[model samples]
Target: MADPVILVDRPAAHVARLLINRPDKRNAIDHAVRQQMAAALSALAGDPDIRALVLGGVAGVFSAGGDLPSMKGLDEAGARARMAHIHGLCRQIAEASLAIVSAVEGIGAGGAIGLALLGDEIVVGEGTRILFPFLRLGLTPDWGQLLTLPRRVGLPAARRLLIGGGPVDGAEAFRIGLADEVTADGQVMTRAIERASALAQLPRDALLRMNRRLEMPSATLSDELAREADDQARCLTGAEFNEGYEAFLARRTPDFSHL
Candidate 1:
């Protein structure tokens, strides 16, 4: 039998940890992983004993983003549906009463970067890399990044990342406000759990309300989610995406000059 893609454990009385276990694929989020995460997070949200949650990935690597093979042949409608499922998972994280932390060790790229940002506090390993390569793939940002990135890193930095596809290391991530804390190599999960433990001791209702107040203003979550779907659908159906996908599979730089 195959190993479960998502692993749940209660490391402390008030803390739950959700580990993405697909290290063989760099913990890429496929349909099964998405469904499993959604179910696990939903259950955690309703557990009164769980005051905090830590999300991490196996083998020192966080997610590499969406499983490209799973997305290879998707049409516009299919792309939108897939993104919507991911959006639901993000919504679960955002709305959960439990304080959430992302223990980022390795790469958190593309949509996975968005997932990391969903955390109330992101603990990053010193060597970890965070990037958004959506433009390189000829795709728009999805998974509510359009809403969350600016709130974390401000509008100008967000534009540089989303448009220029630049990458940031843990130190740079902290300097730019993209990461809440940076720890020594291999210590991200430990630090994240420590932070979660501290957060768990706070008044739950007050914590939830404070999180809500910190949320990005001027647009509802649903509105930004809808915009993400629409924009991704448009890009997914374009010829440029085809070129980019092919180049990715061939391990070569894509030529987009003609597009």
Candidate 2:
């Protein structure tokens, strides 16, 4: 049998890394990839020991975007269903409790960039190419790009990039807030994993609430204040806060394992 398209590895106690392993197709996302990715993420979501996740692709390539060959015979209904599945996965990433970091290298094009943005941070190699190819391909952007991209780079830049812009390198991506960090080619995964591991050290429960609160683009000031007040109240009464307060008083780091 062939190797699995997605590989799950635990590089740290609280960090789970999922690598797209279909190197022959340059890690193109397809039906198989989508199903496997969803299953893996679902399993990780329930594991209290895991607090962070790293998304990457093997052989130094992020992804070539959606698998074009897989789209050859798809009818309109099929296409719609496929996009729905992808959007569901995007929602999963958006609401994930674990901190997420993307390790991007050779290329992240079209839908792949949107997928990467669902995560909290992205680390790219200096030479990595980030492209928007939706219009050029006679398609509108999918994979939640319409929502996530704007939230990531703001509406002005998102419009510019999605409508007609050409490819941008990793350094340019970092400069434009498309990427969180840019490193040398060979160190992308290492840096991404390191970032995720560090993020895992944070109080994950509070972090999840904070992410959810901030990602709500439609929430008004009044709405956010009400939500924030409730969320903060819960956090204050949680065991994590007690531990954190004790640690602060002792001038030591908080160990929140299973707290």
Candidate 3:
């Protein structure tokens, strides 16, 4: 098989490094890329040998977010399906038993920003740029951007980034609590792996449960959890989901149904 668009490796016995490999595209995610990301994550979800995950981009770029070309062909149903898929992946990262760290070195935007926010810890390179430019394209935030961003940086900061349509550097990212550490150039991923490897040595189950508890909502916990599961189940059975999954494995853009 050809190399996966998302590369996964077990650098340490208990820690897996998952890297988005399409640097040329600035790691922009298309249907296939998103699917592969989900697949790579699912592969490690419950593996006994894996205790943590480090998610990063290539040498510098984290991701520029969703691929506009791939998105252009999507119809209403297709758009709904695409949102569902992206949401599912975000939820997975949110719920992983293994700790996840996002190592961002260059730029992250749109849904890619959502991915980074899923991490328990976010490490950015000194030169990294973070942007939320969805409104520029007349698109509402998808991929949990609506959910995670506000919580990470608070409503006012989130509004500033989303409505301002500009990039924030690593320092600002740290100031906003979006990034845990700012590392030297080319060291974000390495540092993330080291951190994850150390975390992997802890009691895995306890750590995982802690993450779950941390992610749990303070209000309507039972209601929200049930709703999340219900929506996910409905989304999984949609035609757009099927088409997107097949296109992803085939390394091509998805041809989504009308509904």
Reference-based TM-score of each model: 0.82, 0.96, 0.80
lDDT of 1 by residue, 81-105 (tens): 9878987888888888888888888
Q: How far is candidate 3 from the true structure (C-alpha RMSD, Å)?
A: 13.3
Q: Candidate 1, residue 220: CA error in Å?
A: 16
lDDT agreement of model 3 with the native: 0.79
Clashes of each: 0, 0, 0
Cα RMSD (Å) per model? Answer: 17.9, 1.3, 13.3
Best by lDDT: 2
Runs of candidate 3 exceeding 4 Å displacement: 220-259
The residue-by-residue lDDT of candidate 2 on 71-125, one tens digit each, is 8888999988988889888888888888999998899988788889899999999
Model 3 residue 65 lDDT? 88
The residue ranges of model 2 lying beyond 4 angstroms of the native Cα positions read: none
Ranking by lDDT: 2, 1, 3
Q: In terms of TM-score, which candidate is stronger, 1 or 3?
A: 1
TM-score of 1: 0.82
Show the lowest summed lDDT stretch of 10 residues, model 3.
202-211
lDDT of 2 at 154: 88
